[model samples]
Target chain A: MKRHQNLLMALAVVVLVALPLWMVHKPAPGPDGKEAEIFAGADSQAEGLIGRIDPGYRPWVKPLMEPPSGEIETLLFALQAALGAGFIGYWYGSASTRARLQREQETTTSC
Target chain B: MHIMEGFLPAKHCIAWGIASAPFVAYGLRTVTKRVREYPEQRMLIGVAAAFTFVLSALKMPSVTGSCSHPTGTGLGAILFGPAAMAPIGAVVLLFQAILLAHGGLTTLGANIFSMAIVGPFAAAAIYRLVRAARLPFGVAVFLAATLGDLLTYVTTSVQLALAFPDPVGGFWASFTKFATVFAVTQVPLAISEGFLTVIVCNALARLNPRELQEMRVATGSEQEVQA
Candidate 1:
C-alpha cells in the first residue's frame, strides 16, 4: 500500500507536467476566437512585457558565454538534469541498501 | 524565476547583490555547521542540491499557455532549513548563468534572492505553520512546496516591476503585468513541484527514516506516515 502511494504520487507529477501541454494543444477559443500561443518560457514572456512597458529600456550586461545555439542550450539543460538525477539515484540506492541491510541485521539479532 | 541576464538595471543588480550577500553567507555557514555536526547528512545535502539542479532544468508547461520551471528549493529548505538553500540555489543558478546562458551572471543575485532566499524561507515558514495546525505530512509538504514555487515567481515579478515600471501605470501596473506572465503561468508547475517534493519525502521517510528524523522532518508520532 505504501509503495502504491509512492507510485501514485510519481504518476501525479507526470500528469501535472503533461496536463498543461494537453490543454495548450487544444485550447478553448478565446474572445477573439484565437488559439493561445504554444508554451513559451514565462521568463521570455516577462521580457516581452518589460519591452512593452518600457521600450527605451536596454539590458546593460550580457552573458559571459552564450550556448551558441538552441540545440546546445537544450543539451546543457539535459546535462544538468542528468547530473542531478544521477546523484539522486545514487542516494536512493545507498539509502535503500543501507536500510535493507539494517533490517536484515535487526531480524537476525532479534531471532 | 530568472529575471534573465542583465535584464535588471545596474543599480537594481547591485542592490540585489548586496541584499543577497548576507543571506548567502549565512547559508554557507549554516551548511558548514550542519555538515560538521552531522557528517552522515552529506549525502542528503547533495541530494537536495541535485534535486534543485534537476528541477530548475525542466521548463514544464503551465495552464496559462506558458512554461516555467519550479525552483525546487522547497525540499532542501524543508530538509536542511531555509537558510541552506541560498548556497544550493546560487550554485544551480550559477551553472545556468555560465553554461546555458539562461540566467545571466549580472542577474544572478536577484534570481538567487527570489528563488533561493525568499522561496526557501517562505516554504519553511509555511511548513511550520501547516504542521502546527496538525495537517497531514503530505498536505504540509504540498502546500509548502507549491506555495514556495509560486512565491518565487511572484518575487521575480516584483523585481521586474521595480526595475521597469510601466510608464503610465507605475509599479503596480508593471507588477500585475509581470505577475500575469510569471506567477499565473507557474500555478501548474508549482503544483507539480509540490507533488514531486512529497514523493521524494515519502520515499525518504520509508528508506531513511533516521535521516528524516535527524532533519526533524519525521518527528515522533508524525513519522508514522511511512506506513
Candidate 2:
C-alpha cells in the first residue's frame, strides 16, 4: 500500500511539473484542443457520471467553471500554483524551526 | 476551504498544481526525517492519518448549504506542531482532492494555501505572542484557533472572487455568505482546537520534557519567558 501511495504521489508530481511545461512549451494549438483534448472527454464523462449519480456534486462545479485564456490568465494560474507550493514549503519549514527552537530552549535552560 | 472546480479557470488549477510541487518535495523530506526519528513513527502516521480522514468526513452545511469540513490545522498543530503540520496537511489535502474528489485537482494550490498554510501559522503566531505577553496558553490557543478559522474563509473568499465572471462582487457576496454561515459551526471547532492544543501540549511538556525542549530548541522558538 505504501509503495502504491508513493508511486501515486510520484505520478502526481510528474503530472504537475510536466503539465505546466507542456502548456507553456506545447505548440500553440494546430487543431482541436491541446493534448488535453484527448483526456478531457474521459474527464468530463467521469464528472458527468459523478454528478448524475451523486446528489452532493454541486460543490465540485465552482473550480471547473471556466477555462483560462491568453497570457494574463495563464500567468495568474501559474502565480497561484507557485504561491500554493511555496506556502506549503514555508509551513513545514516554520514548523521545523519551531521544533528546533524548543529543543534549544531545553538545552539552555537545563544548562 | 474547498476549491471547487469551475471556481477558477482550468489554467489556474494547472498553475496551482505547479506551485504546490516544491512544497510537496519539502514535505516529503520532513515526513521522512520525522518518521525516522520517532520510535513510534508508524503510530504517529496512523494517528495523523486517521484523524485527518475522520475530520474530512465531518462536513457541515453553510448558508449556501454547500458542505465544508474542518481544516484540522489545530488538530495537526497540536500533535505535530505547526511546521510538521504543513506536510501532513499538504498530504491530506492532496489525498482528499485526488481520492475523495472533495476538492478540485486544479485548485489544489489555493485550497492548500488557504487551509494548510494559513491555519497553523495563525495558531503558532498567536501562541508565541501569548507567551511573549505572558498570557496563559489557554487564551493564546483560543484566539489563534479562532483567527485560523477566520483566515481560512477570508482566503477562500478571495479565491472564489478571482475565479468568477464578475470577480469583485462575486467575491464579496460569496465571502459574506460563507463567512457568516461558517461561524456557528466554526466557533465550536476553533474552541475545540484551542482546548486540544493546550491539552496535548501540556501532555508533551510533562512527558519527556527534554525532547519537547529539544523541539523548541531545534525550531529556534524562544522559551516562554514569564513577563
Candidate 3:
C-alpha cells in the first residue's frame, strides 16, 4: 500500500511539473502574434489592469525598503522561508521528544 | 495572492478592511481562548504560523511569467478550524508586506480576504465534507489543499473585477479575463500544493502523533488518524 501511495505521489509531482512547462512552451502566439508571459502573478495583473483603466492613478503608499535588485528580493524571501521552516521543524521535534518522555514517565509510575 | 500596494483604490481598501474586521476579531478571541485553555497550543499555533509563512514564501514557476506561491492556509485550517486562521494569516501577510515587499499595507485587506478568509474556510469545509464522506485521509488532504489554493485565486479575480470593470463588457467580462489569465498558472500550482500538503501532513502524523491528536481535538474533529 505504501509503495502504491508513493507511486501515485511521484506521478502527481511529474504531471504537475510538466503541465506548466507544456503550457508555457507549446502554446502558439495569439491573434496579435504575441507570446503569453509564463509567470505574471495576480498582483501584477491587477496593477496592470488598474493602470490601463486609469493612467493617472498613483499608488498612495510605497514600500519602506526595496531590495537592490529582483534577485536580491528573491534571495531575501528564500532566506525568510528557510528560517521559518527551520524553526517549525525544531519545535515539532522537541515537542515530540517531550511527549515521549512524559509517556515514559507515566508508564514507569504505573509500574 | 498578494494584491500590490495602491492597486486598490482607497475606498476599496477601506471597504475590504472593514469587511475583514469581524473575522479577525473573532479569530483573535478563539486563539486567545485556546491558548489559555491549553498552554501547549501556544507553541503549536506559533509553529503553524511559521509553517504558513515559509510555505507562502516559497515561489514556484508559473505560466504567467510571474511566480506563484502556495498560501499554506489549508493545513492551518485543517488543524485549527477556518476562523482561527484569520489572525494568523493576517500576521503573515503583514510581515510579507513590510519585510518582503511582496504585499502592501493599502491592499492588505483585499489580500487577506482572498488568502486568509476565503481560502481557509473553503479548505476547512472541503476537508470536513470529504472526511465525513468516508474518503481516504490522503484524498481529503489533497482536495482540501488543492481547492483552497484554487479558490484563493478565484476570490482574487472577483476582487479585481469589482475594482476594475471592463469598459465594454462590464464586471463579468473583466472577471472572466482575470480568471482565465490566472488559471494558466494557478491550476498547476493548486495541484502541486495539494501533493506538497499531503506529504507534510503525512510527515507530521508519523513524527508527532500526539501533536496531530491535539490538533484533531482542537479542531473538534475526533476521527482516528488512519495509518
Q: TM-score per candidate, in order? A: 0.94, 0.55, 0.84
Candidate 1 regions with alpha-carbon error over 4 angstroms: A25-37, B219-227
lDDT of 3 at B38: 77
RMSD (Cα, Å) for all candidates, in order, is 2.9, 16.8, 3.9
> Which prediction has the highest DockQ against the true structure?
1
Two-chain DockQ for each candidate model: 0.80, 0.04, 0.48
Prediction 1 TM-score vs. true = 0.94
Query: Residue B151 in model 2: shift from native, Å?
Result: 1.5
TM-score of chain B of 3: 0.91
Q: Which 10 consecutive positions of candidate 3 chain B have the poorest summed lDDT?
A: B218-227
Docking class of 3: acceptable
* Per-candidate total of colliding backbone pairs: 0, 42, 9
lDDT of 2 by residue, A8-106 (tens): 544543453334334433235656755522212112332343343343535435433233344544354344345444543453465557668887998
**Distance from true location, Cα of A34 in model 1, Å:** 14
After superposing candidate 3, which stretches have Cα over 4 Å from the reference? Answer: A1-11, A18-23, A26-37, A53-56, A95-111, B63-65, B217-227
Q: What docking grade does candidate 2 earn?
A: incorrect
lDDT of 3 by residue, B92-151 (tens): 898888877878888889888999999999999999899898887778988999999899
lDDT of each: 0.89, 0.52, 0.79
